[model samples]
Target: MEFLQLKYFQTAARYEHITKAAEELRIAQPSLSKTIARLEEDLGVQLFDRQGRNIQLNACGRAFLEHVNRAFMELDNGIKKVKDLAGMKKVSISIAMTLPKILPKLLSPFLNQYPHVHFRQIMEPPSILKRKLEDGEIDLCISPVPFGSPAIEWKPLFTDDIYLIVPTDHYLAGRKSIHISEIKNESFILMNTGFSIRDLVDKLFNEAGFTPEIIMEVNDPETIIGMIRRGKGVTFISKRDWQYVSHLIPEKIRINDPNWHQMIGLSWSTKKDLSIEAYHFKQYVIEFFEKT
Candidate 1:
């Protein structure tokens, strides 16, 4: 019914979980629930089907979501245009990425050059990041895998090698490299389902004709490495991770397949025209990768 109510509805609908949406919106779960209920009542239709603690958007909700998304996007663009005209703080760029640690390296120099520029970083799985990018929730994204969306454009940054890592005390620690089939029965720790690396690892296992014996699904790479160090299991990591973790001396088992690597890159929506500052920042990232 109101502008803020639409925002609340959009957040709740995006996640399809009231509590999770509330947490993201920085509001109480009851408050979010009440807001959604008021919105549904105002529209005189059931937007979401309530099932215990979970919720799913129905057909009506889905249709309304598209309109709401576009409306907000236009409003944001107008506001950004006004800010640019006013020359207030060059621009505010919201970027989503799978790796939070890389933000400093990517933004530090650029921010130094344009002191008026501001940045908002969102660290999320590639799947969610893709959705946010499409919805115009973020200006651009850096991802390890392609989103496969026609509305989005992706540019290859670099090829990052994937490695199979094991605890130093594990039996396979002595091996320089190994096939996925060799570790079929070994316990494993992996990034949770939505992460691009997890998807690739799962596909690799499927191609090898075996399922990894997963023992833990976590969100943090550092924690996964810690678990592997304690002999909890093993996982596939990238060269970037290996750099941070080399001191641990975990055995890096290269996958036998030559193509067992991910193409890390930048992605942005083509639907919306970029502001001048955003365009320049995007080019900076492109050139930065080109030089590397």
Candidate 2:
């Protein structure tokens, strides 16, 4: 079957509805349907079962999806590799991330070291990033992909020690660390709900046999820090993230436990091509961690 047809199928299966997939692909519904039908014909297999207006993948479709995904992934990798070699050595690193605490501090140094390299950073959650990285849509993801996914190669960057961001005048502001149980009744202004960091927070609270009050939820750590500055609530983030804004910390170390930390890392698609730039960026990141 044609690659475009497989793409159409993927979009359709993703939404589980023809109209939505057509809208996403920006194509006419009838034309999309015909293309899918042609794909099924070419493959000599029924990929989906139509139930009234809704569609569901069949057993064969499920099996073929894996191969189709791999095919496109390899194609994208080949294109990137060719571009890396032909282009003006402007190695473009696609990073889906939360702004790191050390980004600005390290960026000038990084640029000075590799002036030819260019960066395309996108701030997104790990789940979306994991899907894009696996699909070869990005070169390297510099966020926690969560639970060590097997589809991509994972490189551990560092153990991100957790720190609590409390208001400048909070009761815990005078202490170096706060026990997890001490904040049993305290409300938290935290990252979005689906984040791996949030999951880690839950696990920590669970281990302490307490649930945070959870007064507010936010997506960005900077915003979380801002909220804490306004005394809205307290939140936790990694030392790497904290380093980026430690000057504004305002004596706000709300650490409940000193030992708690999260591991952050880099990831790349195992099925894709690794351009020299991507390779160099990965090595630089690893070396940074090692030197620290």
C-alpha lDDT score of every prediction, in listed order: 0.85, 0.77
| Reference-based lDDT, residue 182, model 2 | 78
Tens-place lDDT per residue, model 1, 1-292, is 7998999999989999998999999999999999999999999999999996599999999999999999999999888776774567457789887666667887888877776778888878877887888888889888786789998999988888899888888888878888767889998899999888899888877877887788999988889878888888888888776876688845887878766888888999989777777888999998987876
Q: Who wins the TM-score comparison?
A: 1
- Cα misplacement distance, residue 180 of candidate 2 (Å): 0.8
Query: What are the runs in model 1 whose C-alpha is more than 4 Å off?
Result: 1-87
What tens-digit string does per-residue lDDT give for candidate 2 at 1-292? 5768889998998887999999999999999999999999998989999985589999998898888888889889888766665664577677665545466655667777667777777776677788887888888776655535677898877777777777888888878766777777778888887787887888888877877888878776677777888878788877767766678775546565645787777788887876676787778878877887
* Candidate 1 Cα deviation (angstroms), residue 4: 41
Top candidate by lDDT: 1
When summed lDDT is taken over every stretch of 10 residues in candidate 1, the lowest stretch is 82-91
